[model samples]
Target: MSSPIRLYMSMSLDGYIAGPDDRPGQQLGRAGGRLFNWLDGRKSGGPSGQVYREAPATGTVISGWRTFKLAGRRQGDHHDGVPILVLTHYGDEGGDGDVPPGHARFVTDVEDCARQARAAAGDRPVMVQGAGAVRAVLRAGQIDEMEIHLIPVLLADGRRLFDHLGPDHIELDLVRRLEVRDVTHLRYRVRRPGEAA
Candidate 1:
């Protein structure tokens, strides 16, 4: 069997992944970079810094069109050789031939994207980034694990991670929690609709 799909992302205390007015140059918006301060060794000690620096590379990355655009669409350097599958609408013009060879591909259907990602991942987990891709995979019941890095700052008005997940109730079982300075890393196992939390 292939490895499970994992949704891994960093968010603010208020559950926002990016601040308002996010754009090309300012991807995180005003002061939103604070959410990733720990990764740059600005807010943590040696141990935490090492943890961030020495983290294992993901096998595959799946992101939304907005994220792929915001990231500048570089080929090999973007995800350290890991293939990135971008999820976008079928008729959307932005999905055409933008990605470099051997780096990423455009995928329209959520389930097909997941299947391809799994196949590409082999024995490693497929990491899903961006709110749109994450929501799509989650709604499809394709995600098996969720690892959220919760930062200390809270952006009152921004794009929330779970803002528009419809009215469905998704349950998660807490698997692990670790405090790395000002950030809290939470790992959860996503449960099916009828499964107990």
Candidate 2:
């Protein structure tokens, strides 16, 4: 069988996943989205942005409809190079996401999205992107691993990254915590239902 879904994202010290007022032109900046800089070290040849550049060259990258739309409208069609999956109630308009070098598809359900991604990814990796959308996968227990680039900055009030799904928690172990320049990159493995203590 294929591997479980993997969620990659970052968080702040205050717990605000994104900048609070998420209006157009007033996005994560004022809402404490500075945390993205943690992964900023990954510039063209730098460290922080390397995770994004070296992520196994997957078949597709999945995101929420909002994120996809926002990136599409704001960035003006630049969705990395892999195919993208946007989960939302809105229909796939094709113009809402980046013009991928691979492909792009809009999906509604999580399972169908994963199946399609697995097929497209082949032996490569599938990136479950966007902080808000990743919480859904985590809540559903569909995520198997995580690669979080822990930055130093903090947001006073941004988007909250948690799902508030009962009191249950996903167990994780530190696979690596490397300090790249001024930023820190952390890797973790989600513990299964009945693993070890």
Best by lDDT: 1
Number of clashing residue pairs, candidate 2:
11
Cα-based TM-score, every candidate: 0.88, 0.79
Clashing pairs in 1: none
Model 1, runs deviating above 4 Å: 42-55, 91-93, 96-102
Error of 1 at 149 (Å): 0.5
lDDT of 1 by residue, 1-197 (tens): 67789888889999998888889899998777888876866345654554464335568888888887788765434457878888888433446544444677888899999999999888888889889989988988999999888898879977888877888988899997878677887889999888865
Q: What are the runs in model 2 whose C-alpha is more than 4 Å off?
A: 1-4, 31-33, 43-52, 73-80, 91-102
lDDT value, residue 53 of candidate 1: 48
As a TM-score, model 1 comes out at 0.88
